[model samples]
Target: MALQRKDQDILNAMSLVESTKGELQKLRDNGWDSLMNKVSSFCEKHNAEMLVMEDVFVDPRKPRRKTNITNLHHYKVNCFYTILDLQLQEFNDRFTEVNTDLLICMASLSPLDSFCEFDKEKLVKLVKFYPDDFSYGETLCFEQHLDIYIDNVRRDERFKNLKSLGDLSCLMVKTQKHLAHPLVYRLLKMVLTLPVATASVERCFSAMKLVKTTTRNRIGDQFLSDCLVCYIEKELLDSVTNEKVIERFQMLNERRVVL
Candidate 1:
């Protein structure tokens, strides 16, 4: 019966935990109780009726006593969760509802490293999901479709006399005058706009590491937070309202002597 098979699957998954009891016990001994609890909770909540063992491999390296390193063994357990067909459909529909033009623009502006790794098939899928929104009118929807857009543009007498980026910009400016939906116009503006890179966040962390080196590792968490906030948000620090400054000074003065 289907019910029996589902029950068997759950049992098989639980058996994997039982087989790893020794490792799990070691983890508990090492103060990983919270992690163990989370894994147990995930299994309980997911209704993972079937668990299948994947690949298992053992390291050929000899154990090192000084480093407390032992032979490594890796194993994986696969589990499945059931979802209703309607739920899946609803999820797919929501993503499909996003405007194609906006999606393409966002995708174009996404980190180069992230977008470069996507395959042609994935790109096609994305385009298909939001076909109506993209400005494939100016350029081909896909590299393969480039000729289509080019032919369309070439045949249009309005664009026949236009050439170069300046001409394209002028056309775009003229077209904006007739936009019916303000939301679409705003979305287009956002997609065309370049996003500022967050290299400063990385720089801030590097500065924090330099400031809190081995010698200062014992620094209190609160003090370290205050120091970093002041250093990183120096501009905002200068703009602190007079009322806040007065309240802070009053609190500090009350804690000690008035100067």
Candidate 2:
């Protein structure tokens, strides 16, 4: 049964690759030959065979033009989605296999990182999910009187013997007290505890607000999205420079003038 399940898994993975043939071909044509070799090597290492149908051997006629923008876009989107799907699957598999105790520790420590967005409800749900591995009162709070929760836990004799939890609680209390500015302390606590390390979400929102304000209230959603992307990703926007912006503005002005 185990071998059969493994074979089925392999078949499913192969099906995913087969379904993305157009994408694979585009990658091959666009100097992504290394990616094609990696995919082939992955299949070979896993003892999987590509079951190519008759239609797979036939290539459709290429467009007469030297450039193929539509095909390029389609290929890029397909490849991106396929890779993202595989990564998410692997992440889910690994998450499910994590030890409950370690997961609790992660939950406890996660809030200290600057990148970790604190969600008390999610943490409560996580605690409930692994009740046997973690006691509800074991959590030490960094702010908003979380120390009270820790105090309540420490008062219980049953938890007093757990040196690690006691030590962590003590350290948290010391850190909270010594950190002078409350805001800085909170941010530092978040940075130290959470697994997330980046402020990209905050940065994105900042950029979005800069682009989409009351002055541009009438902007279309698609245009707003493009603007946000261009603003947030400066390297991509470099190709569409001041000249392009001026040209677009002039075109719009001419159209309005004629109307």
Off by over 4 Å in 2: 1-85, 95-119, 134-147, 150-259
**Clashes within 3 Å, all models in order:** 5, 14
Model 2 alpha-carbon miss at residue 225, Å: 53
Task: Give the lDDT of residue 170 in candidate 1.
Answer: 48
Writing each residue's lDDT as its tens digit, candidate 2 over 127-246 gives 444455444554333243444443443454443343332244455466453243333234334323432222445577788889989999899989999888878788677888788787
As a TM-score, model 1 comes out at: 0.25
TM per candidate comes to 0.25, 0.22
Off by over 4 Å in 1: 1-197, 241-247
Over the stretch 97-174, how does candidate 1's per-residue lDDT look in tens digits?
344233433443122232232234434444444455555551243645423433443454565454332343345457
Backbone clash pairs in model 1 (N, Cα, C under 3 Å; residues 3+ apart or in different chains), count: 5
Candidate 1, residue 14: how far the Cα is off, in Å: 49
> Which residue pairs clash in candidate 1?
9-49, 9-50, 10-49, 101-133, 101-134
